[model samples]
Target: MTMAQRIGFGTQIRKSPFFDATLRWGATGFSVYNHMYIPRDFGDPVQNYWNLVTAAILCDVAVERQIEITGPDAAQFVQMLTPRDLSQMAVGQCKYVLITNTEGGILNDPIVLRLGKDHFWFSLADSDILLWAQGLAVHSGLDVTICEPDVSPLQLQGPRSGEVMKALFGDSILDLRYFWLRELDLDGIPLVVSRTGWSSELGYELYLCDGTRGDDLWEKIMAAGAPFGLQPGHTSTIRRIEAGLLSYHADMDADTNPYELGLGRLVDLDTDFIGKAALARIRDQGIRRKQVGLVIDGPPLSGPNTVFWTVKKDGASIGTVTSAVYSPRLDQNIALALIAAEHAVLGDRVDILVDDQPARARIVDRPFYDPKKTRPKAELKAG
Candidate 1:
């Protein structure tokens, strides 16, 4: 394709620094997220999932943009954005947090990195949190500067990711604890390496601090991982569903509350936040819908469902299946669904319309792969 043909998608949508690198390395399809082009395809998704679990895969996740918050009142201003307690979050630590609205509805679920005493970066899922923060700062009597920094991230995830990291950053990278981060210099290539990722596997997110070095960063990591069987891949939907990770707009959105997803642990009612009062009311009254796991009874799904499948208990519709996939390892069709609280009992069976064809499923436990997360938490001692 010529440059004009390649660039015909319009310049309004931003491209990541690793955009060109991704296409060269086998990225076949793309999707839009946070107004940026995100690589969604790099061959068969099932093969991508296997490549991730068995070995390692390098994913260009620059679309997971960072919203940088800094200033004297930064900490306080950040606290107002979510119900999660940030008082005990030490510097260089990472915490998975839910950004909520005043109505106690979830805005986005992001992993926040505490860079300094008053500096933080919200590694977002897929929403405009930068605009939200800037808007909040205008009226809230807080002195905080909110802006989008020139940062892009790549995910090097799988069982052998540590070996890949050690090859690139040496033994010191092993000491980097899970959910913690440290800034590192890779031959003068700026980065903030963190032991965190969306996949429930031992992995690291390499945040490229300089946009100009995107190509260099991608090539260096791939070269180091080549000996370890690393393949260029996209985030795995089958694996993520097995891990029970919530997608921002899919599983829960602006209308979904924290309690419904069994994520009340992230909320601190004692501390005042944007949605404390509304959440307290929810806590008192109880939630209407609840998130649950399901084992759909049928043949293996051809692929992950693209739309919400209607879930019905008996003859009446109760909820909808947000995410569903066929786990090759488990040999079962697993799904995450949201249904009325009264009908969400374990072992209860429900009917679902899979492409308008009737199907049956039973309520089951989620994170079907690793509910305890023992794999991701396992130490990275050199072999």
Candidate 2:
């Protein structure tokens, strides 16, 4: 039995290539590989990459998630775990689904990518979602074999992603739509192209069959994008911080509900699935804590893991900061926090505890960076 099994917490596992590569890049550079620990002393990407105005960032997120479900009842078995109705999912389509426990806590956010009629892969968080799915399968007596495919995913994100992709893979890429995916042969090698990314920028995830092909794809994209200013980039937590995207375990965990994490849209409580009852209760009864945006009054926050937020209107601790960062895009210190539901209204002024000292902050809407969500889909050029 694994460590998770000994602890009886399902199948929690470590990331394959887990390490921090920030210092190796150079001075004032840092990166978090596969949702590991927050590293020390590194400048935010927005400060460094902003002058380029537009950038093509490459990220290796192979450890993000990879769960394979194969069996006669694979589709039906997986469908029972999510509240989103998957009966209409046609083959060759991918849908974002939330996996919830019986108490309605999110297990791990994963994308249900349909590879074929019988084959489906759940791209997941670092958490042990594979064990959870397997336990459910066995408990329900469903005959299915779940495993992770020997594959690594590369995220090519930035304004110039499409242009660079076209140069490397040809014009056929333009045919794909947001959230859509296709399998194609690039230079005699088969690859999967999914129009998805985490940077909240115009990006595409090319799932190469093996790690050997990754170098070729990387070199090809970089060479094609040299003119477009493409560069190797890992996950920019600070950039994502500005984007208002919540990181798992950092923002929300088993202790928090989706509604409290500003992700209620991801939960379809109307359907019959695990945690549907609990989620309904949370929605109807209302959440005590809410995720809110914080605009720091003082200097920018340097890293993740600091308790610099409070939900006090007039000297009372009502909330706490979950994720904080210095936003280079906004040129201000921004944070996401869980506060009393009443104190979460937009434009409400609150106090943030910076270094044990209270600093003035204001509650704002989510996505402190891009309000329009314009980066996911590229604009079609006029023919």
Candidate 3:
């Protein structure tokens, strides 16, 4: 039997609108994110992983906080926040952006959604980016208002997700292209729906505009998705690891640069931003360590690793495994590791110290499940 600890709830850590619904549906574990409680698991991780891949799953990812930026200079001010050139980003489109410090360190990787000509939302990861944007705006004299709006997001993900969405919102939702969003109204409740998700599966995120209707919205989705084998689930570490998705504060952090994390494409040197100079310098200097994928020779891991497992080369510590899970589909323990650039080449061998015992491992390409990534962006026919 595995020992578990109880998580005490308090006002300091806010609860999502679907908190009660998640509890009633059997949320077995919880974790704190963005000062809010995120449902970590419902039951077995392996079962949840299978469910997400085979059918559909409703996730309470309202822990993804939103920071709204609006005003005349909103576009320019928002552009100053990241190295990505946002000049070509059309309204109703979303871009995965990294908010870096002046030192070129990644502060948070948020989805930048353009809501209107002068309005944008930074759907943040697990960091307090509101203060960072506010502080920057204060000194820059940009005519933009920055604050967290009353918006919360819930994700419906899986192969059958499009069918559930079509059932709930009709055929128009099917027209939404990948990374595009549209304002929607369901039963008089206003929302913003986006074709995006953490899992590399077919998914959509419904951003609840009205917090008071959280329970009602949750029930409505549950009822609509019941016929499609939908279940309440948390984000699966196994699926994410298989997809090579990076979790903030897990695979990378404030001290980690985007280039080292395989996010160099996000940095546009031609466009000036907060970390442009530093990133340019880093690009010129080159990175010493790079994040890479690993396949390990071992039995299934007990659970998701809590700390970085030491990775060694010839008995000397060279790097660490940031995230790892035993992939049932691949039949091997896969991991995302930060290793010396020299050792990050494909097929390079290394040793991973799991539970103090060294296990043989090799460098491999990521997205261990689907290399083509066709599922998430595929068009689904209406049922």
Among these predictions, the greatest lDDT belongs to: 1
Report the candidate with higher lDDT, 1 versus 3: 1
TM-score for all models, in order of appearance: 0.97, 0.85, 0.98
Q: Model 3: which ten-residue window has the lowest total lDDT?
A: 1-10
Q: For candidate 1, what is the lDDT?
A: 0.94
- Please give, for residues 1-383, the per-residue lDDT of candidate 1 as tens digits: 77634754678789999999999999988888998999999989889999999999999999999999999999999899989999999999999999999889999999999999999999998888889889989999998999999999999999999999999999989999999999999999999999999899999999999999999999999999999999999999999999999998999998999999999999999887898899999999999999999999999999999999999986999999999999998899999999999999999999999989999999987778788999888798865
Model 3, 65-117: lDDT tens per residue?
99999999999999999998899999999999999999999999999999999
For model 3, the superposed segments whose C-alpha errors exceed 4 Å read 1-7
Backbone clash pairs for candidate 1 read none
TM-score of 1: 0.97
By TM-score, the candidates rank as: 3, 1, 2
Report the CA-based lDDT of candidate 2 relative to the real structure: 0.71
**Candidate 2 TM-score, C-alpha based:** 0.85
lDDT of 2 at 354: 72
Give candidate 3's error at residue 91 in angstroms.
0.8
